[model samples]
Target: MPQRKIAIIGAGPGGLAAAMMLSAKGFQVQIFEKQDYVGGRTSSFTKQGYTFDLGPTFFSMPFILEEIFESSNRRLEDYVTLKKLDPMYTLSFDDLTIKASSDPEKMRQNIEKHFPGYGKNYDRFMNDTRKKMNALLPVLQNKHASLFDYLRLRSLKAIPQLEIGKSLHDVLSKYFDDERLKLSFTFQSKYLGMSPWDCPGAFSILSFMEHEYGVFHPAGGLNQLAKAMAEVVREHGGEIHTGTGVKKFILNGTRDISGLELDNGETIDVDDVVMNADFAQGMSQLVDDEKRRKYKNIKLQKKKYSCSTFMIYAGVNKPVDLDHHTILFSEDYKRNVEEITKSKIMSDDPSVYVQNASITDPSLAPEGKSSLYILAPVPNNFSGIDWHKEKTDFRDLVLDQVEKRAGLTDIRKNMEVEEILTPYEWEFDKHVYKGATFNLAHNLGQMMYFRPHNKLREMNRLWLVGGGTHPGSGLPTIFESAKITADLIARTYGVKEEKA
Candidate 1:
């Protein structure tokens, strides 16, 4: 039998997942990535012998990644070395520090120390969310092609656990009396780029997943996941063309996409095309404006989006005593979140997440040197913040906050190399829409069947994957999106395995 050809746009985790799956199913898979390297936002770069992950420092939900590799007859352990973090992360509030642990008993003890008499509430939270996650995780693995599809058996069963009409902050408030304690769980909403007050109650499972399954760190970096998937694709006879980008999709007639025209002006035919690029960015440039009704450029511009980030990757001359991961909350965290989400302005006090991977893995830096990957949540490109001018000042602000809050006293003077990625760069250079790194917001209006379909609604033979699609963002959901799409494509083509 002849192999069917699939062309995937972007070599991010979503694209790489689909490539490996389809290739394993005996299809001719080819992935085109704009960047010189694979992994899109998940890729990494080195400076002064120090390596840094471009995005996504936290590696949670290891089972999702494991499932993908297992389905392709590959073992994840063979490709990437994952070390489970015991005190998964440290959350620093203005008045207290929380040593977040995956072990429930340890976490309960920590809760007792910080918020006395609150350990029982932590137990209650775990019990409640475990049930919700059990019902929700499987439903997320399927594609919601239509309203009817969303009402399927699995989703129907999950409806009761959905915790609709409440925000994450609202849900956590029921358990914790202290606002800072609530912030510990609610700050996870930032992972989706949504304000905790705006992020849905159902997403409280994000914090549960971390405390339940534990967070992980790859030996090199989180970016290693992409390289590992790319390796699997090649092993399965799939081709990955990095440093190559698709200029546009060629239409057969009106709604049928036949092939892709490369940026280099080379045209290639495909049986199907999977888009892993940012939905708004890809749709605006790749599809004709006239044909796009739901995700038209004007409409997309108006949609609620996740806040962008200001990133600083610095290789310090000396090592610092810090946890593997640390989140330093602003003095006025709620106001800071509001500044990013509602005000759409840079904040005077920004909540920052810093990863000292060198402390966890010795390979990321040279002897006695460490690399610091710092991310500060900021307004998306819609804010008109003039990052070109503000980049230096923002960097200084981030450094000041780090030194004051995180106790990294000498971060400023010891920089061997420094790289900054602002929202402007994310949009203009990285092909992200509005420079919203977390993609579209996870509001009720933009979720489930309302979100961009796994199967392109207007165009046949075209599919969508990644954070922008159904099930929503984060590494696990993005992987689930690819699985859902791969399953749909396989079913559509009536592809079947031969019985032994």
Candidate 2:
């Protein structure tokens, strides 16, 4: 029998992982990434002797990536060294500061020291979320292609723990009396680019995953993980073509894709095509409007998208006296969130997250200097807030917060090199739809079977893998998306995927 050839579009973690698995399973795999590099948003860049990760500085759930590597008969550690951060990050409120530790007792002690009576509830929260994680594990591990998939025993068992109608803030409120403490636990909703007040309660498991599994940082940076996956694909005889992009999918019939037309005007026939590009952008651009029944441009316009971000990657002349990670909440965080999600505007006092990665890994910056990555969540392109008009002022406001609240004093004066990425760049340069950095929102209505399926229901021999598909966004889940897609394709070819 002739070997099946698979063409994967986009070299993001999901696309790369699928290639790694399928290639290892004896399929001919090729990945085409428009970027001159792999990793997409997860990629890194260097300037003036400073290195910075383009997205996702916080790495969690190593086991998922480990499983991906193991599937290829390789070990993750062989490619990148992992360091578990203690006091994972610093959470800054108006009048309080909490060093979030992964150690249960130490975290409890810190909570008691700050919120007094709320310390014991920490244990209660952890205990309950552990059960929630277990119940949801099978659901996340498998495909949710149709409504019937929800009736499976695993899905049925998970529904009770899903917290159906409650928001993440609502779930955290049950454990902590203080609103600030609750915010500490629920702010992780931002990982999905959703406001905690609107993010589903089941997502409280995000904070739990952090405190339980602990946060990890690879030696070279999180971008190293992407580079590593690309290497594995090569090691397994899979081809990865950076700087090449797909122009459109060539149809075999009304229901199937038989090849891809590249931007260079070349067409490659393939047995299957895996789409790892931004879901909305890919559907709107590469797949003809007539070919898409469910995700047509008109329909996609109505779908909820995650918020965009205002980013500043700076190389400073002096060292920073901060933890590896720091989150500074706005004085009026609720209103700030509203401004982003509801009002569709930028806030004057926006919440900011800063990463002083040079403290954790000196390789990121030259000796005696530091690299700073500052991110402020903002409205996506749908907001109609002119980024070209607001970005300059917004950048100053964010830097001010970093200097005053994060204690990175005189940062502007010490800056040696810098790069700024606004929503405009994300949409135009990065090809992200609406510049929704986290992709589609993880609202209950858009999750599981409602989310784009791993196997494209609308097109035969085509698949979806990325934050845009199940299980959902975030690096961990994105990796799982790759696994699920790869497994499904393997099953179609009668290849049994080894259990991780």
Candidate 3:
């Protein structure tokens, strides 16, 4: 029998993992990435002797990556070194600061020191969430390709734990009396780029995952994980073509993708195409309107997207006296979130996340210098805010807040090299739909079977593996998306894979 050939678009984590798995299973795999680098948003860049991760600083759920490497008969540690952070991050409110620790007892102690009476609630929250995670794990690990799959026993059993109508804020309010403490637990909703008050209750598991599994930093940067996956793909005889972009999907009749037309004027016939590109953007750009029944341009515009981000990657000549991660909440965080999600506007006092990675890994910056990654969530392109005009003032405003709140007092004076990325760049340069960095929102209305399936419903022999598809966004879920898609393809060819 002839070997089946698979072509993957975008060399992001999902695409790379899919390539690794399929190639290991004796399939001919090729990945085409538009960017010159392998990792899409997860890729790293070097400027003026300073290295910075383009996106995703937080590395949790290492086991998921380990599983992917193991599938190819390799070990992750051989390719990447991971260091677990002690105080995972420092969370700052107006009058309080909490050093979030992964150690349950230490975290409880810190909570007691800050909130006093709420310390015991930490145990209660962890205990209950463990059950929720157990119930939801099976559902997430499997596929929800049809209504029948949605009604399966495992899915039905996990529904109650889903917290059907409650928001993440509502779930945390049950445990902590102080609103700020609740916000500490719920701020993780922003990982999905959604407001905690609006993010669904089941997502409270995000915080649980962090506190339970602990956060990590790779030796160089999180971008190393992407490079590692790409390496594994090559070891398994997969072809990865960087600086290559897909022009459009060559369709057969209206139901199948026969091949891909490349930007370089090259054409490759393949048995299947795995789309790891941003779902909305890829559908609009690569597939004709008449070819897609479910994700047509008109329908896609109506779908809810996650918020965009204003990013600053700076290289400073002096050391940064901060932890590996620090989250600075605005004085009026709720209103700030409302501005980003509902009003569709940038906030004057926006919450900011700063990563002083040099404190954890010196390889990112030259000796006696530091690298800083600052991110502030803002409205996506749908907001119609003119980023070109607002970029300078917003950069100063964010830096001022970081200097005052995050203790980066001399950031401006010590800054040696810098890069600012607004929503405009994310949309135009990165090809993210509407510059929604986290892709589609994970609202209950758009999750599970409602989210795009791993196997593309619009075209046969085509698949999707990314934040845009199930189980959902974030590094771990995106990795799981790759696993699910690869498994589906393997099953179609009678290739058996070990169960996770």
Q: Number of clashes in every candidate structure? A: 0, 0, 0
Clashing pairs in 1: none
**lDDT per residue, candidate 1, 1-500, as tens digits?**
43789999999999999988888888899999989999999999998799999999888998988888887889899999999997899999888899999998899999999789999999999999999999998878887778897678888989887778999999999899999899989899998998999889999999999998899999999999999999999998999999998888999887888899999999999889999999999999898899776778889888889999999998998987889999999999889999999999889999999999999998999889999999999999999899989999999999999999999888888988899999999999999999999999999888888899999876888899999998899998999998889888888888753321
Which ranges in model 3 have alpha carbons more than 4 Å from their true place?
498-500
TM-score of each: 0.98, 0.99, 0.99
Question: In model 1, where do residues sit more than 4 Å from their true spots?
Answer: 497-500
Q: What is the lDDT of every predicted structure here? A: 0.91, 0.93, 0.94
Residues 1-500, candidate 3: write the lDDT tens digits: 22999999999999999999999888999999999999999999999999999999999989999999999878999999999998999999989899999999899999999788888799999999999999999999999989898688898889999998899999999999888899989999999999999999999899999999999999999999999999999998999999999999988888888999999999999999999999999999999898789999999999999999999999999888899999999999999999999999889998999999999999999998999999999999999999999999999999999999987788898998999999999999999999999999999989989999999878999899999999988999999999999988999989987533
lDDT of 2 by residue, 1-500 (tens): 22899999999989999999998887999999999999999999999899999999989999999999999888998999999999899999979999998899999999999888888899999999999999998999999998999889999999999999999999998899888899889999999999999999999899999999999889989999999999999988999999999999999877778899999999999999999999999999998898789889999999999999999999999888989999999999999999999999889999999999999999999999999999999999999989899889999999999988988778998998999999999999999999999999999889999999999887898899999999999999999999999999998989876533
Model 2: which ten-residue window has the lowest total lDDT? 491-500
